[model samples]
Target: MSDFFLNIVEDEPQALSPEKVWKVAVIDDEESVHQATKLALANTHIMGRKLEFLNAYSAKDGLALLSAHSDIAVVLLDVVMETPEAGLGLAKAIRHDLRNFHTQIILRTGQPGYAPEESVITDYEVNDYKTKSELTRTKLFSAVYTAVRAYQNLTSLAAGREGLRKIIDSASTLFQERSIAKFSEGALEQINALFNINSDGIFCVSSAPKNPSPELAQYLTQHKHVDLSEVDNDFRVIATSTGYRDLFGVPLQQIPKKEVRQLINRALTTKSHVIEDHHIALYLDTPSTWQACIYLHSQQDITDKVDHEILKVFASNIALGLENTKFLTQLADTAYKDDVTSCYNRNGLMERAIPEVIDSNDHAVLYLLDIDYFHEITEALGFEYGNRVLNSFADKLKDAFPSDAMIARMHSDVFAVIVPGHGQPPIKRLIEHCSNQPLILENGDALRLGVTIGLSIHQEGTQADTTPESLIRHAEVALNKSKEQRRGSATTYDESLDAGSLERLNLLSELRRALSSNELELYVQPQVDISQQCKVVGMEVLLRWHHPILGNISPGVFVPLAERSGLAYELDLYVLRHSCSLVRQHPDLPPVSINLSAMSLDRGELLDDFASIMERFHITTKQISLEVTEGCLIKGNSALTNLQRLSDAGWDIHLDDFGSGYSSLNYLLRLPISTVKIDRLFILELKKTQHAATLLTGIIGIILNIGKRVVVEGIETQDQNDFVANAGAEVVQGFLHYRPVPFLSFVDEYKSH
Candidate 1:
């Protein structure tokens, strides 16, 4: 062995005083054989265990002795005693007959002629074979010591293998416990898998008295029944009823004492052993809040280097796993939760919440809310600011819904909430809240923001299904119906609303082909210069669609339909180019003003697209007037900028259908324009509503004062015409003169007139 190994073996203190020496067996029949074996092995020591010799004159006597004391490890036997193979027989008998597996048997021979060296070792089951003359003092001690060491290795390997098997089995058993009740029961099984040194009731205690009340954070060495104790804050005796006092032979030292404190402080700061005792191994972590110690029984001396590594790894994995489980659980909770709104995001609603709502047995009142004119806010403020608005709106929605209610963000500007055991009253309250809450921007701009809400009550046994998605669709239908009412109110979905939505869909599809099929025809109504004595100065182009099957559809229905379907730009371009062409073909016709939808005003392609079409028909910009409604200009600076771009591109800009939109005056002054065509609503009650007449007069005066022309639309009677003329309006265009006609009919009328 190396010097290091020799030092380790020598440093091991004696666990017990020199008691009854380990007995040795000598089995030989020769008269001097007994004396020779005793003389060779007498007063010998191997691994700190002394030797006491015992002689057996025959195989029978040795077997008898082995049966009495089963702990004998080494035996010296002579082979050529009674027969030439007596020792081999005795060795085999000891193995099979007595079953002394732990005993190491050695064979000794006096005559080499009877038992050859190689043959005896291979044939005999003894540990070693030696000639009687060569059995000297040192060689005999080496053989006995080598045999004892082999026996110790076998014992330790067997114990280690058995302990590992028990540990795996314990871990498997703990994995199967179904409830918390079995956790404490399984704890004993896990601890029992650890190697036990002696019969001290599975643990040991210190002799020193445990200072009952120690100072804060002082290390304590005491008998603790449970190492993983949360309730026992101080040190206490473990299993006192079992045998704490009897096994320890001394009381334990109390924690928080000055000596214990110093030990703890030293343990935390240094890498060396802070407490060297027979009971436990102490370790303190200064970088963290916890402290720990491992108890080692006196009989279980720490020999292997692997023990400390195992304990440290086990401790770290346990702590990390506990913390990881907690962190993951909290993270999962917040993942489904929306912090600002206290509602679910779309993913949570679709995956988790919808299943819950479906399982509910009670009737659910579902409301789908969409902010009316939300695009205006996004256009006025930036999108980032608009997101803040939406977040704030979501918070209000959460407040409006009950605590147990389910709410979700459905779309960009849409939200959905469900209330149990409630119906229209709650939906009405939500609508009122939406309408009443004025959105306050960061710039101190307050807007009376309103939302159109759709409500549907899904109860059992109804014709409609109560699935979450279906309920949302029903609510969306109601929202469309409410929007048609134009009051920012709540509406319930019904069969009629479904049918109306389908009809609108059909119309939208047909309208897609209306312009391409040449089904739409433009008709001009002359605006007479009554102030210039009935002379025609400008004509308003009124749109008329003649379906091949359905005869003349009103502009009011198809016009708005076309605007929403993105086809109004085509119709406006057609009217502007065709009207200008007609005026160029007939020089007597004045500048024709065609009514344009708000969508056309927003298109950057409007002016250039129109000029290209006019150039195709060989017409100048002065031949046609591009007219946009007051609603177009009311959309803020984008409308004004586009109008100014068109005017700068040499197209006449007229504010057509004036006095129809809210805040029209503000836009009228701001937009670039050449004329104002007063809406028929302002002129319909011109004689009946005196205030309408005064408003018209004031509007006309405002237009003329700005050096712009004023065309009073819907003049159906001479009296209406005379009323407008008397009010100093320069032009008049209405059905009293002519309704919209086909281009060929207008051509014939112009040629004949």
Candidate 2:
């Protein structure tokens, strides 16, 4: 990574109160806003919690922070950055991509016109919408507090709901325990942890002897602590929150309070519960062999009637007791194992496999395998069938690896397995089996599976074995690399891949800087009207980067770089805005055509921005032309609609790179295009292949027949220029006629003309 990207790394946040701090993220492009927000919210508290601020100066930085800090309670978001909708885009990413629905997003904007409050609120789950100008320090503080409270309330409700669910599950499990003594203990613990209380609970179990002396009965009822040798003979405390360790396994009768003994006896005799102001003793409806009672205490009142009733009903049902151990195992399995496949899940992998790999003295290899086109399969077949297929896959995995080997379903169609030692993992064989072996579903539908595997090996005593997180991360990177190459391919982690990624990030950082600096410039190449003795007709605008160290960089290098870096929209807007300014300044210039990416058109916002730019520059649509390729047709309805819209608004639309594949004659006739620029490849290949010249001539003739003008691209020789002129091309753009010149030079030339 370059120093430019280093600027995004924020300083470590100072520790707030560990137990009672709401993490709030400030995501804005302005440094002043970050400082003001920090000052305004310095001492602000909401829901008995002080605020801890995490600042991100850009939408990209904000997203990275959100991903890292899942505990963020609220996001103070600005509505514009590189583009008008950058903040909105980040909000969508948070909800859909990050799967973070709980974080309250208070959308703040400097310019309200760019974002309509009603629509943005409806669309992006905005909690509170405010403009920067209206946000007085006091109002800002109040707004944050309100949103923070909403976040706290929402999370509390979620936690409470989850707690209730666990309580019900544990309560049901309590009744299913086979042993009467164990059953009482389970109920006592569940009641203490899950219900509306925060004090100790004790469960006592008793079994009457067939024949016993007075001394024996007295000794069983009240004596010493229970231990390994002691058996359940009479009533005894199974569990209690007695502070002294020595009192833990002692007899229930040893407690100083007379109510404790009386309460247990009353509940046992009545076969019900004895409730008091501070404590409740419930009788366990266990087997006839043994009797049990659970004594619980609450410092606070059981205000909720429903909770009280549920606890009583829960204590009343202990007669089931069938397969208790198995039921508990399944409940535990649901947490760590996949519900459908019954294999380990991601949590299971982390707990069980990560430690093994880090601790093992033997070499270990981790395989991250992905099933290709799994989503498509689910879409075509039903999700039920997809689950069945997953079950089949899990079974195969079990059969392939040893029982002790760690296998887990990381997520969706992705599975991971760590095979410790050089045991010959049989990974290749497993892939072969999946490919050749058809999975016969419950409905008799058979489908074959294809797998892609990414492997990361950890040699014992190597630095890689120190951290399982890096091992897993490397495997994920390898998986992405494998998929990028093609599906059903295998890849191993390599350091070069990381190097290449860092290089790309550096390039992206540089490009972002170039966009703002004067390092980027638009150049123009004149088009010729051959019939008018090769007179200059129009010009096509081109973007170039003049890097400080590496002068005159190619568009081929940076154009796709901008697209991949999520800066394509910004770059397109810059070109359109710059071209409009050029046309505005030089009133004598012909319609200056500029390229707009199909991606921008499909985004559905850039067209309006383009219109706004034109209106700002006082330039008519006729003064500037929008050029696109066949890629526009496939980018869906938005691109096609926008092309027609621009043409209808009196802007010229030229279909650039014609016959570069994907262009159809039917589409050509239907689309509202005035000019077709044949791809440069034909001109480059004219001398090499006679078929090229024939094809070029045929395409030009067909374009002219439709009443549309043709622009022959990439001509370098007089022969090629003359050849295109005779082939019905009205306008010719190439080095042979007029080489590209800087925008400033083009302006000077026009003025001189």
Highest-scoring model, lDDT? 2
Q: In angstroms, how far off is 274's CA in candidate 1?
A: 33
Candidate 2 error regions (>4 Å): 1-460, 465-491, 637-651
Provide the TM-score for each candidate, comma-separated.
0.53, 0.52
Tens-place lDDT per residue, model 1, 1-753, is 100000001111244457746667888887687887677776776546788888888877877888887777678887866677777878877877876665777778887545545644544445677787766765576567656644443333333345344443344344233222232233323433454433222111211222222411122222223223332233232221133334222223343234433453454346233324333333422112333222333444434423554443333322222222222233334445564455676655655576576576467687778887787778887778777787778767767777767787776777777777553345556677777877665566666668888887778777777777677778888987787777578898887888988888888777767766766777777677777767767667777887878787888998877775677887787677667666777866667777777788787776678778887888877877788777786655666688898888888888777777664565556667877888888778876888987888887888888788788888889888888887889788888776666666776876686
Candidate 2 yields a Cα-based lDDT of 0.72
Cα RMSD for predicted model 2: 17.7
- How many clashes show up per model? 9, 0
State the C-alpha lDDT per candidate.
0.62, 0.72
